[model samples]
Target chain A: MIEAIFEKFFQHYNFWAAVVIIFIGIYATIAKNNLFKKLLGLNIFQTGIFLFFISLGDIGSLETLGIGDATPPIIWKPAEERGYLYVNPLPHVLILTGIVVAAATTCVALALLIRIHKEYGTLEEDEIIELEAIRGD
Target chain B: MINTVVEQFPALIVTTGVFSAFTILILGLLSRKICYYIVLIVTAFHFILSIFTLQHVLTKGRIHYWFGGWRPPWGIEYVVDELNAYSLIVILFLGLLGIIFAKRSVEKEIEERKLPTFYTVMQLLISGCCGVVVTGDVFNLFVLAEVASLSTYALIAIAGGKALRASYNYLILGSIAICFYLLGIGFLYAVTGTLNMIDMRIILQNLYENKMVHVGFVLVLVGLGIKAAVFPLHTWQPDAYTYAPSAVTLIMSTVVAKTFVYALIRLIFSVFTVNFLELYINAWNLVPWLMGVAIIVASILAYRQNNIKRMLAYSSIVNVAYIVLGISFFNSQWSLSGALVNILNHAVAKGCAFAAVGAIVYKTGIKDVGALAGLANKMPYTSGALLISMLTLIGIPPSAGFVTKFYLAIGCLEMQNYLMLAIILLGTLLTLAYFLRVIEQLYFREGNSTQKEEVPFSMLAPTMFLAILCLAIGIFWLTGIPLEFLKKSITSMGVIFR
Candidate 1:
């Protein structure tokens, strides 16, 4: 059991890091009252997912202790030999789209924050709710 | 040559709208008058394209458009079967009507400088909905969902002041949902090594027992559930709907949520399939119970609301539950068609109701249920349309809501799920309990104003058109106009009970 735990800790450590980052991000988004911190938390959460996707493409040769065998996906030789040694390119392409999406979301989110601060002169969630309620129906 | 053009209609439908969005943006800097006209023409063309594709699908079958000339696994694809065509028709047609309604109403609510920007974002939202419905790639679907969602956050904020808070909460929640969806996609991609929907399905069939696939399924469901505003995840919806500009309210309440539900259904039926559920040890058996709770809880919440749009927002949760309930029983063809029909029925009913309420709010700035006392005397047509829509929501006969509810009841009976049937009956009662409060305020209560104030022709036209549609669909539902297409969509799912 101890050996299995050690194996999981050693082999899947990046995913464990991602899981930790995800927890922190969700906690900040849900538990934090400040709006800017929430947005930053969202970005951190997305970065965790990006890390997971990047790690999925990193299968290595048995000789290099799972770290250093796979080359960048660009082809140097023609047919059979080097093709199998290169890492998968699809996740990289998907991450490019993910980055663009994250950028767009952050821009819109910060813009809304500016507007909210302009209107209420505050950026805290509970305070905004208080203002809206005190203003009343 | 004709076959090729027909096959490419799915791609044209999305690109045209997106192309028109940029054009409107550029032309708005030069001239504002031409922008609305461009919007009308683009939506009309999109509606016509959807009709052509739906007809082509019903007769000639599904159309697949590959990006450039590349083949499936490597290239992104746009697929339009009966399911996609049906949703495309609803979205584009409503977008056309919403644009017409927005012309005058936006003039009342939005500043002149922002008009072009509003319409531009509106076009992008429509294009995003089209892209979400018709895409055959999961990652592509996520990108389009963001496009729709980001534009929506901006549109809601365009109202400014009070709307800014609503849009902020929506942004935070919506971003989290999108992240969950992306993580879900990553899990699926890691297991399957392909992003194409068909390719993923083939790969996932063998990986059904894998823990990653299970995690992927739950993540996707939770992500989309929040987007669809189902029950507990629906806290952002009421504020967003209430504070947005009326036209935004009408469109998002009907189109955006419905499109997310469509994407969820597509993921389940097309990518995951019932075989996945069987292999996953009937883990999805919880879905029906979840829908049952969403129906009961959301209806009760709708009952407690005093604000009209907020109440309607809660009711939208109930409508989403009906579709989920239908889809949960995917092994049964009857329930599946019932779910599909409910999509159209709820869209017409909810869209018309919101439009009429917008008309009333435009004429008199009242949104509370009690403040609408004697509103019927001043805005008879708008109030009447609201009455019809509310009746439809209550599932009264001769209304579109009744037809879908009838099918759902039948579906429940055929499944012999009496508890869910009881829940449905209780939900209809709850809908009646809430809507009657507004109806009484509309008709029975004394007038605050003496003079009659009719809504503008542009606004009244679309509201009445949808109200009349409520009647027509209920009367002709047995006539197989929507029934035939719904059946084709169901058969396309290839559900088998075993």
Candidate 2:
């Protein structure tokens, strides 16, 4: 049973890796005191999801069908004639959009951080919270 | 099939909003004063288009527009079913009122230089909401939801000072929520390989017991629940509401939150269907219980707040819970209708309440609940609007809030869920307790200021209009005018009314 589980784990190592990276990113986001670090963690978290999505698009070897390594989804005459198994381009498109959204979020967060730093003279979350409490804001 | 002009209305409404955002940005460089007019014209146009869209849907049928003439399963589709059309009208109506009200409020609250950008972002926010409502694609929903949320963050941050922190907190949490929603989308995509909601729904009929599908459903629920500010997931809401500019607060609390709830309802009833919920997923069974806690707990929290906006923010949470609870009684037709009606009811009532509070802050710079003492004498129209809205919120007879509670109670009786019925009544009493505090302060208490200082006519008109709408909608529902439309929309969504 242990060997069977290990075999399955090794077969889907990419998903396991993605999950682990996501948890690490979540931990840093939740536990980090520095606001910049939190933003970095958030980016990391988003990157993990992006990785998961990209992995989902990968069409690995299908020996029974005699399919080899998946090719990029570039539709051309020769590739179509050869009948190459192209990877699903939809998830790639989705992740590209997701990446744009992540970048925008980061830009907004960084702008807010700059304003927060200018106002509070610190990037530490606890320090800022304490300051707010002291000022009764 | 671009056969007719009416078919293009859905795309036109959304594009106009996006186009106007840019127009405002470019034109504002020439003259900032034109930005408000641009938003006003665009929102008014949107409201008109929404009305026509609803009329079309009611008379004809669902209007489906495929992007680039691509087929449904492949390309993004814009659909205006009865529900979407109804939600569009509600959102655009509130949005127009919000824009009308923003003229003086924005000038007063925002910096002079930032006026153009403020109007631009507000336009984008409204368009994003329209996109969310109209789109039939789930991924498109995510993108539009992000657009709306990002614009919301910017609008809140524009308030500066303590608002900066509130906007930042909201940004982080909101991003996380969207990411979870995306993750849910990813899971469903992996399983079903389709992103069109209707297509996915058809494919998911056989896969209801799939573990991944279950996870996807739950993840979507969690993500949207946070966005909708449902009980436990509402940590970022109060701060965002309290610190955002008054216009921002009004739009965000009403239009933005209602759109998210509409999205939740769409996903639950349209995509997942009641069969999925009844057969496999029991997670929804917890919704009513959590909302029960939310109604009581949030009302108590609202009662304890010193800041008037903060109090209203907490009250917003309770109202959100009310909508969710009403809908969560999925078996009962009355409850579903009540939930849908409450969206418009709460939006009108809360929009007026916040507008009144904003007017108070605008003229007097008063934020405390206690400081509202004798406001009725100074700004009689604004205070009177606030009183009417507050009474509506407390579910008094012949008001919109009462209609929702009355329907919801009957819904509970239909389901034989007596406990939820009791909770609904208790929630009303609690709502009465908190809103009564403000009403008493508005009318009964003695204060120093007695000058006649009403807000600008532009602002006061919208506030009074919404307040009047609160009672008008209730009377209309009682007369079965709008309720028939709501029931038609609900039935069209495959929900049967007994």
Candidate 3:
């Protein structure tokens, strides 16, 4: 049972790292009072997800039976005759798109923060809520 | 040549709106006056094209347009089946009315120089919604959803009061929701090795027992649940709707929320087939109970709201729960029809209500219910429209809201869930209680001001049109056009109905 547990651990080590990062990020987002930290937490959480996806696409070199040999995915020669395995490239592409989306979200959030600070003179969520309550009064 | 051109209409509808947004930007720099006309022409064209697309999908089969001639699992594609076409028509039709209503409301609310930019972003937002409904590629759906959401954030912040904070909260929470969506797609890709919705469905059938698939399902559910503002995740909605410009509130409450719900339905039914739910997972069994709780909770919260727009926003949560309730009972024809009918019924009724409120605010600048004492005496037409819409929202007979509740009650009966039936009836009473408070203030209580004229023709036209549609749709619902269409859509997605 211990050997099986170790095997499982070794197989999913990247996922375990991702889980830790996700929890840390979520905790920071929920528990932190600063808006900037919340944004950063979101970024960290996204980064962990990107890492998990990229790792899922990474397959090790397969040298047995003269198939899936380690080689770069270039079109220099016929793909079938090269007798080499190419790690799946789709996840990298998806993550690239994700990075762009993340960047756009951060840009918008930062702009909003700048606006909020200019208006409310505070960066903490609780402080802003208090200020809004005062204004309501 | 004509057939080829007709086949391209699905892609054209989205491109037209986006390209016109850019067109409005450049032309606005040249001359501000022409921008409105250009937006009008573009939205009108978009509406016409959407009607043609829906009619074509109904008459013929689905339209599958490959980007750059690439096939599935490789290149992006736009697929317009009956369901997408119906949603497209609804969205574009609302966009048309929203832009028209914005002419007067925007003039009243915004600075003169910012009008062109307002139209530009509005088009971009509409195009983003259109793209979300049309795209067959899941990644593309995420991209378009962000486009819609980011534009929404900008639009909400445009009002520049409490709007700044509201938009910021929405941005943070919305970003988290989109991130979860991306992660869910990543997990699905890991298990299925494909991103095309149809291809993913085929690949997922084999991976139904995989734990990753389950994780993906849960993540996507939570992610979209947040985006659709389902119950506990709906904290960002009330403030965003209350603080945004009235025209923007109209578009967001109607088109934006509807688009996310449509995407959720697509993900649940199209990407993950019903059989997958029955055989591999039982997570769906919890949906009806959750929605029932949401219906009760959201109504009670809405009942307590003093701000009119915020109250409507909370009530939107109630309508969304009803939709989810219908889809949860996926096996029943009544349940599915109830959900589908509510999409149209709720859209029209809510649009009328918000538009009328916008007009009232435009005329009197009041956003409170008690402050509207004797408003019916001054703005009779607008107030009358509000009354009809509020009754429709409260599910009174001879109104669209009633049809939704009737079908849903029958659905509850079909499922033999008498407890849910009682909850729904209780919800109706609560809806009446809140809306009647506003109605009584409008008609009964005395205002200290003299008589006044109604809102301008521009705003009144769309408000009255939608109010009348609310009544027409409810009274004519038994004619079965929407029912037959919804049944066809549900069946076309390969969901079997008993």
Descending-DockQ candidate ranking: 1, 2, 3
Give the winner by TM-score: 1 or 2. Answer: 2
lDDT of candidate 1 over A7-115, digit per residue (tens): 7676778878888898899989998999999999999999899888887876542213544456555646545544356777778788988999999999999988988
Across B228-330, the per-residue lDDT of candidate 3 in tens digits comes to 8988789899999999999999999999998998898899999998998888777688888899999999998988988999999999999999998988888
lDDT tens string, model 1, B1-498?
235577888888788889999999999999988888999999998899889989898888888788987788899988888889999998988888888888888888999999889999999999999999999999999999999999999999999878888898998999899899899988999888888998898898888889999999988988988898876788889999999999999999878988999998988888888878766747678778888999988988888999999999999989999999999887677788878888888999999999998998898989899899998888988999999999999999978888778888888888889898899889999999999999999999998785888988999999999999988887878676766667778766655555
lDDT string, candidate 2, B284-375, tens digits? 78888889999999999999999999999999999899889988888888898889889999999999999999888889999988878998
lDDT of 3 at A64: 37
Each model's DockQ score = 0.87, 0.79, 0.69
- CA deviation > 4 Å runs, candidate 3: A1-7, A61-70, A74-84, B1-3
Please provide TM-scores, in order, for all candidate models, with all chains considered together: 0.96, 0.97, 0.95
The candidate, 1 or 2, that scores higher on DockQ is 1
Best by TM-score: 2
Residue B27 of model 2 has an lDDT of 97
Please give the distance, in angstroms, between residue B286's alpha carbon in candidate 2 and its true position after superposition.
1.8
Residue B302, candidate 2: C-alpha displacement in angstroms? 0.8
Candidate 2 local Cα displacement, residue B60, angstroms: 0.3
Candidate 1 — which residues are off by over 4 angstroms? A1-4, A61-69, A73-83
lDDT of 3 at B65: 89
- When candidate 3 is compared with the true two-chain complex, its DockQ is 0.69
Order of models, best TM-score first: 2, 1, 3
The fraction of reference A/B contacts recovered in model 2 reads 0.73
